[model samples]
Target chain A: MSATAVLRVDNLESYYGPIQAIRGVSLEVREGQLVTVLGANGAGKTTLLKTISGVMDPEKGTVKLEGTEIQGNEPDRIVARGMVHVPEGREIFPLLTVAENIAMGAYTRSDKAAINADEEMVYSYFPILKERMTQAAGTLSGGQQQMLAIGRGLMAKPHIMLLDEPSLGLSPLLTEEIFDIIRRLNTEQHVTMMLVEQNAAVALDVATYGYVMELGRIVMADEAATLAASKDVQEFYLGISQDENQRGQRRWKQRKTWR
Target chain B: MDFVQLIVSGLANGCVYGLIALGFVLIYKATEAVNFAQGDFMMIGAFVCLGLTNADFMGLNFWLAVPLAMVIMAALGYLFDWGVLRHMFGQSQVSIVILTIALGFILRFAAGTIWSHEPVSLETPFAGQDLRFGGVVLGIDEIAIIVVTVVLTGSLFVFFSKTKLGVAMQAASQNQLAAYYMGIPVKRIQSLVWALSGAVAAVAGILFASKGAIDPSSGLLGIKAFAAAAIGGFGSLPGALVGGLIIGLVEPLSARFAPDGFAGIARIAPYAILLIVLIFRPGGIFSQTQKKKV
Candidate 1:
């Protein structure tokens, strides 16, 4: 509530053909906070991130980045304004070398010394990238590619980073490693973050605040710790039913999506 | 001596083909659209050079006319991309292909009206000069063509590997959406690629014009260059040049050695090689597949 929101979205809506994908989703990520959006497969989670990042146009909402209205702005312009998106499924340029891919992330900025320093900073976090600096990005393992994606995003020196499904296809151990770095980025570097993920358990751990999205709307919003302890989250999202009375209902509800 | 002469001349011809093929591959690499009018762009360049350098016209120096013509063609290319090709982004490759073919016809007619269909020799400072070696003589135009192609290709290779904008263009060619995420303007980069392609075509046209006679129909040479691009693999830049050289070498050899009964085989030699490559290698020699979408 205090630090002043860096990224603010108000009544944002996006569409896919004739169907409404995301409906009136409004959220705020304050400065120096790691926020996560948890949702199921088709809950408009990706659409929300796309709309906020300017990849998809928002039909009737306003996106303000650092108090600048960026609704009709281009994706490249939004990135120049210091909001970088590590898109879903790690869209790293496969043909480009590891170093070149990272260099492209700083394309908008022309400060030579600062960009070099930022690249070194990226190598510090993901040291494996430094070892294979000239290697093509496609050759990296899945977990390493995920790290490269995050490293590339950091090259922008973004005020806030939008991460989509960082844990999508990683092993639990690998996911833990990625999330640790994500937390470090927010706490140590003071870069505000909004992570969109289906891995509720892992996402809730790193996030300070959480929003649970179902269908095209937010069904629940609270602090991360409170949401993790909630009975609804525990039973449906975490797959932990402590009460014997709710066990059968939990089994029946497991097959049903969040309402 | 005749065989060596044939080789020199074949190589010169190949350089022009390679340059045109380079244009095709450059545009193809960035946009995934086949520019059938690439040859017409070459015609326009030759005409532009002719207009500037002819004694009865602007009468600029040969070197001056070359660069001036290239700039005009580059601007035309940038305009075409921004005004026309930009809207075809989401369209299928066939639609773009057909659109470019129609564009070729329009350019041909426009060039025909403005410059006429008569074949005209471009005046150059070194047109009649030659260098004599142990057993073979090389025309200045032939020497210029080889030197220029090698230098241009080498510089382009360096630019893509070393410069920021060049690497960004490479990234954009590989993945448009991902390039956008990196804050690279995908459309602007695409337009720049077109401009670069047009400039390369201008060089090819000027080199060709200085060497021999050229007319409105000279742009038809893009067909052979297209064949060369296919053999090199549509996505690989260097591959297109190599492909062009192969066609270039094979032509003179075929013309010299073919039996009396098959006197006309040299005319169809490039297409024949293209056929073989297609049957054996579906995507060309350096075939680059599309990036897998998530």
Candidate 2:
């Protein structure tokens, strides 16, 4: 990890009306690192990403991108500052053509030559998109739409990306393919990422660091390999218990530790 | 020849309605609110042009007056959204509809107060002139209306497809939240859409005034245009024009040719078409049914 963090969230708090969705969450992603937040449904994973990207304003806390405080800024402004969010469910512009969808990702940019080059680069990552450039995005199959979503995010030339469940609704083969592209984007392009996922096992494989959250709180944090090897994580998250006879007892013990 | 003339005149009138309907579609696509004040916006445009060109007021040339009116109307549209409509964002669809209806009444009342409820004609160089195509006769004003509609609609089509800002506006219209995440200023785009709609309404106003007299009630024609929009597919631009033409043709045709008591049906011709369209194809002719995925 780099000495300086590219992105950081400090004492963050967010809510959906009266219900607090994220509670005093703090985390950092150093430059060129792939960090993953592994949590179950209702674990505030999506809320944290939404707050950082300015989709939903945090009630309390600060988000810093390269040391600039950007909390409560408009989502577009946050995107302009080199951070983009590929939201859960892959919110691709259904009515727009695949090419037009990618063009919109560069809405804040004006350099025509660079934008064209970036677009071609996106095509290289997903050649299928090049074939379907004129087709409406809504017509795409689920995996293809996911690729288009990520491609749209890359069109912004983001320094750090916040990906929320990229593997959602994908077959196992497609999920592995998507994760491979994510890994390549991190390693080859040197793009920093903060990924939120329910697929903890696959996420841990690509992530350099990981955090485990439950019900709006981080229960454990460690290096990805260390966390993956932890007995608590193996039993509960990875769904692997070595002692089958005491599996129920171990599950109870893990719950007690997390609480 | 009389029938042909009626067809020509109806088409010109339909072009005017189509222009107003286009404005409604533009605003609705961006914000999803069917602005009831659209017709009143047209009324304001006509009144503004009249005020500028009348000898008693600014007395500007027809050329200068029309553009000035459009600019003022555009500003008014921006203010309407920035000051009033923006606050209504995320409200229930019913409340927003009611709010726009209330806004329509306010605009009509304001226009009546300012213009004194008197009907006035807009003077243009082409007024009272006619062109003869063998047995078929077309008014110079009618020709101007057709030409302007074609040019404006064509430019708009190109603009949306070819320009960056235009594409951004379309993207914002399609999915505001997704566009926002891509660094497009969605709120600003909404304001811009309103302004553009206002400018188009101004054109419709000027064109209508060129044909005949205009008063505060002239904005009521916007209701016909709204019907036109509904007939075309509320969000489709080309659909607005086709729907307007259909309404335009049906009205005069029914009035002139209908037997006995059926003559009154001309007044409700546009609404009649709307009902038929709603019954047959609720999405309108041009609208694609959207399917939400889980």
Model 1 lDDT at residue A3 = 88
TM-score of 1: 0.97
lDDT of 1 by residue, A47-94 (tens): 999889888898998999989899878889999999999998988888
TM-score for every candidate vs. truth?
0.97, 0.97
Question: What is candidate 2's lDDT per residue for A216-246, written digit by digit as tens?
Answer: 9888999999999998788778988756454
Off by over 4 Å in 2: A246-256
**Quality class of the docking in candidate 2, CAPRI style:** medium
Q: Mark the regions of model 1 whose C-alpha exceeds 4 Å error after superposition.
A: A246-259, B289-294
Q: Please list all clashing residue pairs in model 2, or write none if there are none.
A: none
- The candidate 2 chain A region of ten consecutive residues with least summed lDDT is A247-256
TM-score of chain A of each: 0.95, 0.96
Q: What DockQ do the predictions score, one after another?
A: 0.67, 0.73
Error of 1 at A204 (Å): 0.3
